[model samples]
Target: MSGLGDRILGLGLLVLAVAYGWTAQQWPEPFGGAEGVGPETFPTILSVVLVAGSLYLMVKPDPDAQWPLGKTALELLISLVVLVIYAMLLEPLGFVIATTLAVGTLSWRMGARPVRAFLTGLVSAVVVFVLFNYGLDLSLPAGLLEVS
Candidate 1:
């Protein structure tokens, strides 16, 4: 039972990685000759990385790994909830707003001042939004900010 938790976590992540990769593959292929990255490319890459990491964990789990407790555990839970909420709200609130709220809350929980945390969130969100929407030529959902 020394590394039981790590083993179980590895198994869970392995399953998730397989499912995620499968789902990514289900996305329609880009409407052209397969000459560049498509919708599934990034996800597939992540899934591959996750799979490898999960396999390594299964093969050689950290015997010293211990679950966080008390405040640290609560913080992890809060971060998870924020991320889940961010995903749920992304399409409706837009990437920028949802990312700002998620990042700000997580930052505040990590001991940052409220105003500074939110300002950081706002700046990071705007930068990422611009990077994905403009630099990468990929369109994120504009949601509330959508122009007519």
Candidate 2:
């Protein structure tokens, strides 16, 4: 896809960014607030950056860009599917499990050996989970790993 297609994709992303930012703003205000930030801060910033990027892409689309074909196209499709599934399963499977599955599969696809790929995924997932949950005070779902 080139030029017009790029603009179209940009417009779509712009719309999504607007919607996401609006939704982020609609999150209920924290009660008994002592904290300096809320859950929506990161998403709001992300949406704003996406909006800027989308607008830039829309205005300056590459005219000579070529769309991916064959194996490249298949890989892109597979990556998209993995991300969508990761989003869907995040709550039920928990952040660590879902992230491991998604990252491991992607890493494996990129030529990492299966064992090493999954081990990387597992380590990364755990580290990020701990950082976000403890350091940042962001609560990721524990899912099946929840302690009773």
Candidate 3:
């Protein structure tokens, strides 16, 4: 059963990687001048890596790997619920608060200690904020916090 599942996942990942690579290749380059890597560069590289990883897994899969069952399913369900709630509350609650709450709740559900989970989630939120706001120069909603 586990082997079958892994095989299916591997195949799906392979298809996704191919599709992503093709899509990336089809995207037009915004500018012609020599500068930083184009938008397609990262996606193409990521797709290649995904394809290679999926192929490796398909070729040499572990026999003893076991899929998580009931409790894990419940945990995933809880995490999904929290994520959806966070998305819904994002506009009103603000990015930091909503993201921290969502990540912390998901981490706790996945068996992390409360303090550790909170810290991890807070750190994750900060990292995401820096990456998106500063590194990528992309704007996210400030919501109630007014960070924007």
Best model per TM-score: 1
- The reply for model 1, stretches above 4 Å from the true place, is 32-35
The segments of candidate 3 whose C-alpha lies over 4 angstroms from its true place after superposition are 20-46, 80-98, 113-116, 135-148
Candidate 1 yields a Cα-based lDDT of 0.90
Give the per-residue lDDT digits (tens) of candidate 2, residues 1-148: 4598789889999999999999998988777773666878888999999999999989999998778999999999999999999999999989899999999999999999999999999999999999989999878898878889
**Residue range 1-148, candidate 1, lDDT tens digits:** 6778889999999999999999999987767755466778888999999999999999999889999999889889989999999999999999888889999999999999999999999999999999988987667888888889
- Model 3: per-residue Cα lDDT over 24-108, one tens digit each: 8886656665345566777899999999989887887767777778988777778778878998988887677788888888887
**Candidate 2 error regions (>4 Å):** none
Q: Cα deviation of 32 in candidate 1 (Å)?
A: 4.1
Worst 10 residues of 1 by lDDT: 29-38
Better of 2 and 3 by lDDT: 2
Tell how far residue 80 is off in model 1, in angstroms: 0.9
lDDT comparing candidate 2 with the true structure? 0.91
lDDT (CA) per prediction = 0.90, 0.91, 0.80
Write the number of the candidate with greater TM-score, choosing between 2 and 3. Answer: 2
lDDT score for residue 33 of model 3: 57
| lDDT score of residue 99 within candidate 3 | 85
